[model samples]
Target: MERIAIIGCGGSGKSTIAKQLGLTLDLPVTHLDAVYYDENWKPLPQEEFAAQQEKLVAGERWLIEGNYASTLPIRLAAADTVIFLDLPAATCLWGILQRRWRYRGGQHHKDGVFDRITWNFVRYIIGYRKQMRPKVTALTAQHAPHARLLTFTSRRQANAFLSEVTTSA
Candidate 1:
């Protein structure tokens, strides 16, 4: 599929799946974390973030992974497919924990990108659920009906979906 949008809760492996799909399809993958998080985990301005989203989705073929609710209409309008990683809350929590360990365990991301906050896990997992998941689910359902929406309930389902789907761009 061209112009795929992988939207999901934090630590749902949206970036990971998008990157893998991009590699397999020889397409470009854009991680929202890389785009939004600047040095020291500071957030970019709303205007800048919106601009970035616009420029990214302008591509004819690209895979973007994020749960930016404000950019949903823009992103989904241009996307031919939307892969929703509807992982269990437990799965996401576990993923976040594992990631924290990796980030705090001495793995540095691209220059000043991944700060690896040792304590934000609770917020991203528990707090973001009430704050973000509702918005994401609503937006996906709204813009993804015409678009191919692959909602994976678990990691196994995700892998299975990828196994059968040809990622040729």
Candidate 2:
């Protein structure tokens, strides 16, 4: 509840959930995309990115949303809870489309962050369950076994969980 790591494919609502949970729990939120890329979409170097994540997780309470699987262990090891948005591929694709429409001008609601739809992003969403799930599952098991793991298979389910958290908070 205090320290959370949210992971899933693009458009899985990871940032949205992180914002909601951060508000409900009175914790700071970090949208990894905001930090990982500059306004012009230049990436932060890998070493610096990893170091920055290390500093972030050292805080007393935080909710970080991202799927940088390569740097996942840093957050996972520090999290008290891990929320995995495991919605179906079709649902994710639809979400991405809706997001693109919502932010049609390219700039995201997040400051200095831009949204771009690429073929690779679409293919990643389509192949996520088959390709990324196993890796994420294993990483969670290995790095955050003590953390509470919440996996939501649909948007409704994720919303319900958020409602529960809000009530409890």
Candidate 2: regions farther than 4 A off: 109-114
Number of residue pairs clashing in candidate 2, backbone atoms closer than 3 angstroms, sequence gap of 3 or more or interchain: 0
| Clash totals for all candidate models | 0, 0
lDDT of 1 by residue, 6-110 (tens): 887666787668767887887888877778776467788988998998998888899888777887777887888988787767888787667666566332434
TM-score of each: 0.83, 0.95
Model 2 lDDT tens row, 24-97 = 89998888888788778789999999999999999999989999999999999999999999989999888888
Specify the highest-lDDT model's number. Answer: 2
* lDDT at 18, model 2: 82
> Which consecutive 10 residues in model 1 have the weakest lDDT in total?
106-115
Q: Which has the greatest TM-score? A: 2
The CA lDDT at 167 in model 1 is 41
